[model samples]
Target: MSGHSKWHNIQKTKGAADAKRSAAFTKIAKEIIVAVKQGGSGDPANNSRLATVIAKAKAANMPNDNIKRTIDKALGAGNTDNYESVTYEGYGPCGVAVIVEALTDNRQRTAPEIRHYFDKFGKGMGAQGCVSWSFDRKGVIVISNEDEELDEDTVMMDALDSGAEDFSADGPVFEITTDPDAFNDVVAALEKKGYTFESAELEMVPQNYVTMTGEDDVKNMEKLLDMLDDNEDVQNVWHNWQQD
Candidate 1:
């Protein structure tokens, strides 16, 4: 299975509330608010970032009403939640490279809390560019295989024609990769062709993966990931751990 699909399935199997769906909603809402503020528009047509966040919200199963409300609130007068983007790079257990992306109003608290996780469960935190140099940012789109009418050949051809950089069919989904600049155009083209995605987002793709064989190392790595994911300030966690 592809790495993206493996992580996706693992998340799905973690069950609903235990997986912290509510926290997921909050994270996506923060993303919408930030996108609106940065892009200076609520309409997706004018704001490409907002459009991307909207797609992510939909993929997370966030309700349309909730999304609209958040956007409206974000555009309202006197909104004070000005979140700044922060990224932290570190090494998880067994030398696995991990990157965390967060949007926070309080960097002082967020930074310390994140560093604590690394200190407690990893090989200690690193400088800003330490582990990030090993990763490349890419646009990933996932389409489910549940649709009987969906043709793999047709989808692959359409994806490439739509400006996708690469395409793969692994397990239950089709993974389409695109250059970051061409992401929106590719997504728009796929949408016009009536393709609904399981998920779509920009992610850091690791060039090399770490293999963890020690039981203690694997346990600590899981703990580290859980701590990061459960944090309210954290938006996304990217790692290079190769799951067996």
Candidate 2:
């Protein structure tokens, strides 16, 4: 099992219902657009990437109407957004590895902005594969068990039977890990068994966590992540920072 609890970082966004929620919706919408364009289909049944993005959108509490409208817009002839997926990897304060995933139409504008955030908050951005070597790309599905209504052992076995690579009880959630290629299958299999996910997405999971010893380092890290989260181009940020 992973040493760090998957749900710890999710706690950071518990109270966000204003600008953050809107920003999340916008990011997910952009992701839907890109997924539809790249996958060549508006229907999730035929488009695995779009299905993954839709699951992510639903996890973020994005409305079903918003999702339908975004998919319809993506299918429209007048829609001309040509956003490409870009990933930025570097180190945050206290040598914590950081990865930022963005969907942007302009690489020129998004690259420097990410670099600036790193420069202002931690060590300057590094070349690709610098910090990424420390992480594994996996499909992570988190199911809420807050009320203890779900049985952990049963869920774990079910996940494993459904082709999940690993399973763990992360506090109030059941975390299931699957290979990136088999992610959609595992998610669909679990869904068929009447499981609902609190979050389901492909993520760069750190192999180990780094704890910040300095107060200044902690503040800088928090600021850096906040800036990344608020940026419209940035869709997801992954880090090795152990959240308290």
Candidate 3:
């Protein structure tokens, strides 16, 4: 887990979605709609993609009513607009590889906006597979270390037995990565063992990390990331930025 991952955990601890956290809720809603449409099933029990989105929504403390509404919209759709899942690969300041995953009704609108963000920061968007080649998609589960009294070995055993691919310890938290196809089963097993985690979702992890040393470049990179985060169409952003 990295600081960005830790930040998400901390946000949950702070109850960041207390009716006033519109931004997070909006993102989760979009994901739910897209997942439902793509999965071809509004039922979370049968659809792993929908289940993952629901898991993320639950982790964010999003209201149950809101989640249900989004699912309904996806299922009872008389609309013609279909949200196309797209991944745009680019680099940020200091040559930090960036990947933006979006669900859009129009690629015509999203392409140039994503490109503009890179250009504004003096970076150019790369071809579709350029930066994505450096990353692998995996299911990430984050667990807390408060009063649970679990060590790296214990966590590893639990995750590995449930078909988890890897585990990493970052400070007080443990990161669990599983095969994308086996994510739901692994989560269910961990839950059966009374392992309550902070969040579980599919994520893009870089094969190698890039460290930014200078303060100025770090600030610029932060700015670029913030800009991407502010975009409603952008569902998730992954990067190789490792602070030194």
lDDT (0 to 1) per candidate:
0.86, 0.87, 0.79
**Candidate 2 overall lDDT versus native:** 0.87
Report the Cα lDDT for candidate 3.
Answer: 0.79
Q: List the residue pairs that clash in candidate 1.
A: none
TM-score per model over all chains = 0.92, 0.94, 0.86
Candidate 1 residue-wise lDDT at 83: 97
| Off by more than 4 A, model 3 | 1-20, 77-81, 146-148
Candidates sorted on lDDT, descending: 2, 1, 3
Report the C-alpha lDDT of model 2 over 120-176, residue by residue, as the tens digit: 998879999898998899999999999999988899899999999988887888888
Backbone clash count for every predicted candidate, in the order shown: 0, 0, 0
In Å, residue 230's CA in model 1 sits off its true spot by 0.3
Off by over 4 Å in 1: 1-18, 146-149
Q: Which digits, one per residue and each the tens of the lDDT, describe model 3 over residues 70-158?
A: 89988885845468888998888788898899988889999899899888873789998989988888888888886659977888889
In angstroms, the error of model 2 at 22 is 1.8
Summing lDDT over every window of 10 consecutive residues in candidate 3, give the lowest-scoring window: 1-10
